[model samples]
Target: MNLPKIVLALGYSGLIPFFIGPVWLGFSPETAPAWLDRAWLSWAALIGAFMAGTFWGFALPAVQGPAGLLGIFISVALVALTGIAVTLEFAHALAGLALVFMLLLLADFWRERTLDTIGGYFRLRSTLTAGVLIAITWRYLMLPAGGA
Candidate 1:
């Protein structure tokens, strides 16, 4: 299916914040700035929550069925997970958010295959997810020996 230009533009541009964390850390003369880590984690957590809402929207049509209910449940659970991730220490929070994003990508994949069958959407999500994971990994590696 042909995706709207707006969707493609927004989806890819959304990744800018994800990459900003690593880029900021890389340019720092010493360690990451006081707010850099938290900023990055917060951005990730927010995105995770946003993804959960999209998942919920996808499940709306099937709300009468068990799969739809399960989908809704999982979407809510992802928001809770995202909240918990933000409360953790830096390294753990990074890992947690990464996992949440991956799960979101999986949910999108499931939706594509079973729910909507949107052609380019899942591909875009996969690419964005990779970008997010890469950024998270980059920041993780930049952490101090034992992690900050």
Candidate 2:
């Protein structure tokens, strides 16, 4: 189905690095460079923060109620966790990022039941999140110290 072009564009735009970073790393040195690792981790943390903020923005327009309050808290926690996660080891950070995205997708899916998002919003979110998770997990395994 045709989803909102803006959402699709923004979503995929955010996803490109997560998708491409892994692919780029795969073709690079067997032992990935320190700079590349730092760069990808930085990008992942930034994107995670941005996604959490987007959810917070959605809560702003929502009616003052339990759902809106919950959304706000979820969004905030997502950022908080991301901040903490980024400071951890690279392997830990990837796993944390994967969890963060899963929680984000779940939060959006749950929020959509009560609040109004663009049509097919959940589908778009799920697809992008799944793609991100896959890329991260794949890269995680590829990391020398990460699980294989």
Candidate 3:
């Protein structure tokens, strides 16, 4: 099924923050605010947590079985990972968030196979996740040689 226009709009708009970090740093790596990387990392973690919650919601109907339970467990773990990511040193935190995003996508792919989910959502997720990953890598590359 097709996603609603609003959902598409909101989903794509969510990518803006992901790009902001790289773009800002690219333009002014030397003069960018000291908190810029941290802010970007924080935003990534927040979005990751939100996505995890959505994963939990998607997995709810399957709660009667192991698949559902596993999904819920994964969701919780993702949130925890994101929380941990925010507390680490900048480079470590960026790695952690990237890992979390990858895991979340993998989980959603699993969910698509094992449970009911909104049609078109996974495709959108795949696209958005790729964009996120690119932004993350771009930002990472821009980090100082010793890391932020």
Q: Considering every candidate listed, which one attains the maximal lDDT?
A: 3
Local error of candidate 3 at residue 56 (angstroms): 0.8
Q: Report the CA-based lDDT of candidate 1 relative to the real structure.
A: 0.85
For model 1, name the residue pairs that clash.
none
On TM-score, the leading prediction is 3
lDDT of 3 by residue, 1-148 (tens): 8999999999999999999989988987778798887788888998999999887898898888999998889999999999998899988888888999999899989988998888899999999999999999888887788995
Error of 3 at 49 (Å): 0.5
Error of 1 at 95 (Å): 0.7
Candidate 3: deviation at residue 131, Å? 0.6
Model 2 over residues 104-132: C-alpha lDDT tens digits? 88888887886657678788878888888
Candidate 3 worst ten-residue window by lDDT: 28-37
State the TM-score for model 3: 0.95
What TM-score does candidate 1 get on C-alpha atoms? 0.93
Each model's RMSD to truth, in Å? 1.5, 2.5, 1.1
The candidates, ranked best first by TM-score, are 3, 1, 2
Off by over 4 Å in 1: 30-32
Output the lDDT of residue 38, model 1. Answer: 76
